[model samples]
Target: MHSRFLRLAVAAGASLGGLAASQAATIGLMAPLSGPQALVGQDQVDGFMLALEQLGGKLGGQPASVLKEDDQLKPEIGQQIVRKFIDKDKVDAIVGLSFSNVLMGSLPRLAESGTVAIATNAGPSPLAGASCKPNVFSVAWQNDGAAEAMGKFAQDRGVKRVVLMAPNYQAGKDMLAGFKRFYKGEVVDEAYTQVNQPDYAAELAQLQSAKADAAFVFYPGGMGVNFVKQMSQAGLLPKLPLYSVFTVDGTTLPSLRDAAAGTISGAMWDAALDTPENKKFVAAFEAKYKRTPSEYAATAFDAANLLDTALRKLGGAAGDAKALAAAVKAAGSEFKSVRGPFRFNNNNLPVQNYYAFQAVKEGGKVVMKPLGTPLKEHADAYHAQCALKSLP
Candidate 1:
C-alpha cells in the first residue's frame, strides 16, 4: 500500500508538471491550393512560410507547428478543413481563410469554438458588420476597401460615365456597392459575370456599347488574368480608362504583361510602397521567390508578423483564445506593418491607407507605378454596425 501510494503521488506530480509547461503554438492554415486560384493560395502560404523562416522557424522565440490544408476553393471543403483543425487538431489559431464564401462557411464554427481566426485574404462584409466575432480579425482590408478607393479615384478624375464588373458573388456585390458609395456619377451598367468565367468578350462588347468613360472591375486570381487579357484583346483598354481593384495586380500582371499596361488599380499595399518595412519585405520576397509578391502575399506576411508580436506577448502560448485575440488586437497598434497605418477597427477589420497604382512602362519594363494615395487612414463603412465597442 505504501508503494502504491508513492506511485500515485509521483504520477500526480508529473501531470502537474506537464500542465505547468506550455506547448508550442499550432496554426492551421487553409487555402485553395488546387484550383483556378492555386497561385493565390500558394502565395499566401509562401509568404507565411517566409516569415516563419526569418523568425528562425519559431514564433516569438518559441517553436511553432503549421498545418496547411487545401480547400480547393470550395465552401464545403473549407468547412470540413475547419472542423478538422478545430475538433481534431485543436489548433491554437486558424489562418488563411481564402475567399469570402469559404470564410463565411467556416465562420459559424470559429465563433462557437472561440478560436483565434486571422484572415489573410477574405474580409467578408457580413463578418465585418453585426456578425463580427471577438476572436475573428481581418489582417487584410475590408472586402470593399480597394473598390471604394477606385471609385473615389474615378470621381476625382472626373470620369462621368463608368461601367462596373465583377464575379456574381457576395464579394462582387459588395465591391460594386462600395464603388457607388464614393462615385456619385452615373453607372452605365453593372455587369455580374459568373465566377471563374473563362471569357469576357461579351462583357467587353457591352461595355463598348455603353460608351462609358471608364470601366471598374473586381476580378481576382485567374479570373483577373483572363478578364484583362480578354479586354485587351478586344481593343477596349486604351480607349476606355480601366480602373480596377484586384484585377491587374502582381498575380495577374505577369500574365497580362504589356496587355495590362495603362490599367490603374486601387489597393491597400503594393511593391511600390515607399516605406522601410515594405522595401525590406519586397526585396526579401523577390529574392526568395523570384517573382513579384501580390497583395495577398503582403497581407499574409503581415498576418505572420501579427502572430509573432501577439504570441511573443503571450510568451509563445495561445491556449487562452480570448487572451490571444486581445493580444493580437493590441499588437495591431504596436507592430510595424509592411502596409502603412494598419490597425484593427472596432469590428476587427483593418484601417489602412489605400493607393492608386498605374501599370506603366519604365526602362522597357512594365511595372505598377504608384500614382498617388486616394484614401488615407481609411476605416471600413460597416464598423458602426458591429456590436463590439472599442477595446480599452
Candidate 2:
C-alpha cells in the first residue's frame, strides 16, 4: 500500500508539471493552392513562412507547428478544410483565405469554435459588419476599404462619368458599393462578369462603346491578370484612364508588363511606402522570393507578426479563447506593420493608410508608383453595424 501510494503521487506530480509547461502551438493556414489562384495562395504562404523563419521558427519562444491545406478555391472544400483543422488537427489558430467566398464558408465554423482567425487576404464586408465576431480578425483591410480610396482618388481627379467592373460575388458587390460610396460621380456603366472568366472581349466591347471618363475595376488574382491583358489587347490600355483596386498587383503586374502600365490602382501596401518596417519587410521578401511582395503577401506577413505579438502576451494562455481574443486585440492596437502603423477597429478590421498608385515604366520595366495618399488612418464604413458584446 505504501509503494502504491508513492507511485500514484509521482504520477500526479508529473501530470502537474506537464500542465505547467507551455504546449506546442499549431497554426492552420487554408488557402486555394490547387486552382487558378495557386500563385496568389503560394505568395501568402511564402510571406507567412518568411516571418516565421525570421522569428526563428517559434512564436514567442513556444514551439510552433504549421498545417497548410488547399481549399481549391471552392467554398465547400474550404469549409471542409477549416472543419478538419478545428476538429482533427486541433490547430490553436487559423490564418489565410485567398477568396471571400472561402472566407464566408469558414467564418461560421470559426465563430462556433471561438478560435482566433487572422484573415491574410479576404476581408469581405459581412465579416467587418453585421456578421463580425470576436475571434475573427483581419490583417488585411476590408475589401471595400481600398476601393473607397480609389473612389476618392477618382472624385479628386475630376472623373465625372466612370465605368465600374467586378466579378459577380460578395466581395465584388462590396467593392462596387464602396467605390460608389465615395466617388460621388456618375457611373456610366457597371459590369459584373462571372469569376475566372478568361475572355473579357465582350465587356471590353461594351466599355469601348460607352462614354465614361474613366473606369475602375476590382478583379483579383488570375482574373486581374486576364482582364488587364485582354483589356490591353482590346485597345483600351493607355486610351482610357483605368483605375483599379487589387487588379494591377505584383502577382498580375509581372504578367501584364507594358499592358499594366499607366493604370492607377489603390492598395494598403506598396514597396514605396516610406517606413523602416516596410523597408525591412520589402528587402527581406525580395531577397527571399527574388520579387516584389503583393498586398496579399504583405498582409499575410503582418498576420504572422501580429499573431506572434499576441501569443507572446498570452504566454501559456494561448489556448484560452477569451484570453487569446484579448491578446490579439491588444497586439493589433499598436504594431509596426509592414504597411506602416496598424490599429484594430472595433470590428477587428485594420485602420491603416491607403495610397493611390499608378503603374509606370522604369528601367525597361513596369512598376507601381505611389501618386498620393487617398485615405489616411482609414477604417471601414460598416464598423457601426458590428454589434459584439465582447471587447478587448
Candidate 3:
C-alpha cells in the first residue's frame, strides 16, 4: 500500500508539470501559404515575426511561443486550421488572418471558444456590424474605409465618371459599396470579375469603350499584378487615371513597380508613413527581408504589438481569459501606431486615419507620396450602431 501511494504521487506530479507546460501562453497565426495569395500571407508572417523580435520573444513580459498554420486560402481549410489551433495547439490568442472569407469562417469558432482573434487583415462589414463578436478584433482598417477614402478623393479631384471593378466576393462587394458610398459620380461600368480571374483584357476593353474619366478597383495579390500589367499593356495607363485601394500596396508594389507608377491609392498606412515606429519597422523589414514591408505587414506588426501590449498589462499571468480580453481592449490606449492614433470601436474595429497616396518612383523604387489626408481621427459610420460604450 505504501509503495503504491508513493508511485501515484509521482505520476500525479509529472502530469501536473506537463499540464503547466502545455498552458504556457502562445499566439497562433493562421494564414494562406499554398495558394495564389501566399505572398500576402507570407508578408503577414514576416511582420508578426519582426514584432516578436522587437519584443525579444516576450509579450506582457512573459516569453511567448508562436505557432503558425497554413489556411491554404480556402474557407474550409481556414476553418480547419483555426479549429486545430484552438483545440490541438491550445493557443491563447490568434492573429494575422489574411483573407475575408477565412476570417468569416473562423470567427464563429473564436467567439464560441472565447479566444481572442486579432485580425491583421480582412475586416468584413458583417463582423463589424450585425455578426459582430466581442472576441474578434481588427488591427487593419475595415474593408470599406480605405476605399471610401479613395472615393471621396476621386470626387474631390472632379472625376465625373469612373469604371469600377472587383472580385465577386464579400470583400469585393464591400469595397464597391464603399467606393459608391462616397463617389457620388456616374459609375460608367460596375464589373464583378471572377475572384481568381487572371486576364483583364475583356474588362479593359470594356473600360476603353466606356471612356470613363478614371477607373477604380479593389484587386489585391496576383490579381492586382495581372490587372495592372494588362492595363498598362492595353494602353489604358496613360489614357485614364487609375485610382485604387488594396491594389498597389507593398505585396504588389515590387511586382507592379513600373506598371503601378502614376496610380493613386488610399490607405491607412503606407510603407513610407512618417513615424518612429514605422521608420524602425521599415528599416528592420528591409534589412532582414530585402524589401519594403507592405500594409499587410504593417498591420500584422501592429497586431503583434497590440498583443504584446495586452499581455504586458496582464503581468504575464495566464489562464484568465476574461482578464486577457480586457487587457486586449486596453491595448490602443497607450501604444502609438504607425498609422497615427487608433482605438477600437464598439464593434472592435479600429478608428484610424486614412491618406490618399499617389504612386511615384524615387531612385528607381516605387514609393507613395501623400496627396491628401482625409480623416485626422476617423470613425467608421457603423460605430453608432454598436452599443458598447467607449473605453475609459
Q: lDDT for every model?
A: 0.83, 0.80, 0.79
Off by over 4 Å in 3: 1-23
lDDT tens per residue, model 3, 103-161: 88877888899877788888888887777777778889889999889999999889999
Model 2, 1-392: lDDT tens digits are 11110000000000112221133555556777765687788788878888888988777566555667777778888787777767765556678865888889878888999867788887899998999999888888898988999999999989999999999999999999999999998999899999888889889999988978888999888999999988888888778899999899888887899999999999999877778998999899999999988887888888878877887785534657777777888888756798876788999888889898999999999998889989999989989899964344
Which segments of model 2 are wrong by more than 4 Å? 1-23, 389-392
Q: What TM-score, computed on C-alpha atoms, does each candidate reach?
A: 0.93, 0.92, 0.92
TM-score of 1: 0.93
Best by TM-score: 1
**Clash total of candidate 3:** 2
Better of 1 and 3 by lDDT: 1
* lDDT: worst 10-residue window of model 3: 5-14
| Clash pairs, model 2 backbone | none
